[model samples]
Target chain A: MSDPAPQVPPQLAAYRATIDNLDAALIHLLAERFRCTRQVGRLKADLHLPPSDPAREEQQVARLRALAEEAGLDPVFAEKFFTFIVAEVIRHHEAIRDELSE
Target chain B: MSDPAPQVPPQLAAYRATIDNLDAALIHLLAERFRCTRQVGRLKADLHLPPSDPAREEQQVARLRALAEEAGLDPVFAEKFFTFIVAEVIRHHEAIRDELSE
Candidate 1:
């Protein structure tokens, strides 16, 4: 039997490699972003600020959705993706604050 | 000006809708899972357990990677995806413990 056709083009191999590299870079960037978020949590904790800031999260979701659409990604998928990230960040911030207290 | 071609096929529209519904359900399930993780965190905190259980996390990553592969997803992507989720769950658990303390 003949082998199945290739899903991706040979010419696109380089592009696919670039995407993989970018994905790795994105992980590093996300880690850095989490580090900054930890700092923000520290500040918030110091000021006794509430951990869940709905307004700020909404604004962030809107901004990221727009950016993703501009970058030619599905906006709905981007929104869901960032929602998970933001939720995680907020949780991390809360955890940091908890650690600082003890 | 010519209209742009449809990107998704009509037959796939129902499938896409099902995916969207599943996505929403997945969010709900995740939230429920977080709730359970929070309870686990509370128990851990009561028992004076450390938040970072590297061994358990490693096992989780391995198991999920296998499951994702079985589900026909890119194992690497699934690993990264679950890493994010696990991190978030830990953070949430910590947060829940913090709140319980106050």
Candidate 2:
């Protein structure tokens, strides 16, 4: 009798490829979002407004959680994601402020 | 013969608890950092400066990458972490500006 050959599942490979593409798309969208946010920051500077608004951040997190849930994502995970983003925005804002002050 | 009892290593449990505590500290520090950043944002807005500084962001990323490597972390992963944070800061700055405009 001939030895049997090892077989790999094609479906799993296709699913992985699809996930890779989705990840690329996600990164592209995130970049675009950052660009728009930068423009908004410039506008705020022009208008003499502060960078971090707790109330606004709270609203944003709440809204994003709802949107994530609607899109079939875990709300808790979404909240953690937003928390990380919020921390970064505050850091960038501070850097700009320090530069201008100097 | 009696069935053998399942067992979890106490060391593994202790390690997990330590990791959990570290995560909590990381969150707390991040929050404090954001608070400082927000203060910086306000200072910048008062001085009529923009929210996003590409040069500064690049410098910060470079510094962070080096620090991460020194601490036995993957530089690429550290960069991704910083990228996410930068995006959030820009978004928060924009929101602040929009509020002031209104």
Winning model by TM-score: 2
Every candidate's fraction of true contacts kept comes to 0.00, 0.00
| Model 2 DockQ, alpha carbons vs. true complex | 0.02
By summed lDDT, the worst window of 10 consecutive residues in model 2 chain B runs over: B19-28
Please, what are the lDDT tens digits per residue for candidate 1 over residues B1-102?
Answer: 776743433433443354333334344434444444655666667766666567656765676566555544445755777676667657766786677678
Candidate 1 lDDT by residue in tens digits, A1-102: 777743433433443344333334344434444445555667667767676677655765676566555554445655767676667657766787888788
TM-score of chain A of each: 0.78, 0.80
For model 2, how does the per-residue alpha-carbon lDDT over B43-102 read when each residue is reduced to its tens digit?
Answer: 456555577768656766676666656654445756886676567667666666666667
Residue A33, candidate 1: C-alpha displacement in angstroms: 28
Candidate 1 segments whose C-alpha is farther than 4 A from its true place? A1-102, B1-9, B100-102
CA shift at A98, candidate 1, in angstroms? Answer: 47
* TM-score of each model, in listed order: 0.46, 0.48
* RMSD of candidates 1 onward, in order: 20.3, 25.9
> Candidate 2 at B35: error in angstroms?
0.6
